[model samples]
Target: MYVKFRKSSRVFLITVLFGMLMILSASAQTGAPINVRGSITDVAGEPLIGVNILLQGTSTGTVTDYDGNFELRVPADGVLEVSYIGYKPQTIPVNNRTSVLIVMQEDTEMLEELVVIGYGTVRKDDATGS
Candidate 1:
């Protein structure tokens, strides 16, 4: 008795092999997530809670817990931006930083708002002239 694979069977087998090869190649080129751990604190050296920590240009983010500790997994070699409501925003390179401690200073200068009145928008500083 002799057994042989039909043409369609051979084509299906080849297609499956090609798909698996592509999947494996793609996965091998992908990098793993880098672990990031940090603590947020105020200028006075006190731990600041509820501080917002975000990776710049991405939606990945986390908030400091009550102990002012935050841990997140970001793609390797990404940039991170840290900010809080009353504190100045800071941007840091995350290339080799696995653990970090950041002190955020309060922003004393308030941002003036611009409003649109009638036909055009006016800056808060120039609103009186318009």
Candidate 2:
């Protein structure tokens, strides 16, 4: 009985195993969902109510609690978009983080073009050209 166990063959087997491990590790890192918790507040330091928290570039999202706290599952590299009425939308990257604190800023650019000609108010889209 004879067995052939060359050193070169052993090294090749080790290298293959190492390569497979690296590939699997990298694959597990990509698009992995992680649990993230955060709080949303206004610039005035008040907890924002019913804030819309969504993962950027995706439809997955949730709403903040009445206390402005929220928890969601997001990709390790995903970005979050937080939005609320009368507030500017904010985007934040996960970057493998587990917790976040967000302060929402108010938006003042909304223009309700109301034209008053003594009694009726005409919106920009309702005006007619004669």
Model 2 residue 103 distance off true place after TM-score fit, in angstroms: 0.4
TM-score of each: 0.61, 0.66
CA lDDT scores, all candidates in order: 0.81, 0.86
Q: Write the per-residue lDDT of candidate 1 for residues 1-130, one digit (tens) a residue.
A: 1235577788899999999999999865554578999999998889999988898898989999998999988766677899876578999777757898999988855334555579876666777852
Residues 76-120, candidate 2: write the lDDT tens digits: 999999888667888899999999999988875533454445666
Model 2 misses residue 70 by how many Å? Answer: 0.5
Residue 28's C-alpha lDDT in candidate 2? Answer: 86
Q: Which one wins on TM-score?
A: 2
What stretches of model 1 exceed 4 Å from their correct place? 1-31, 111-130
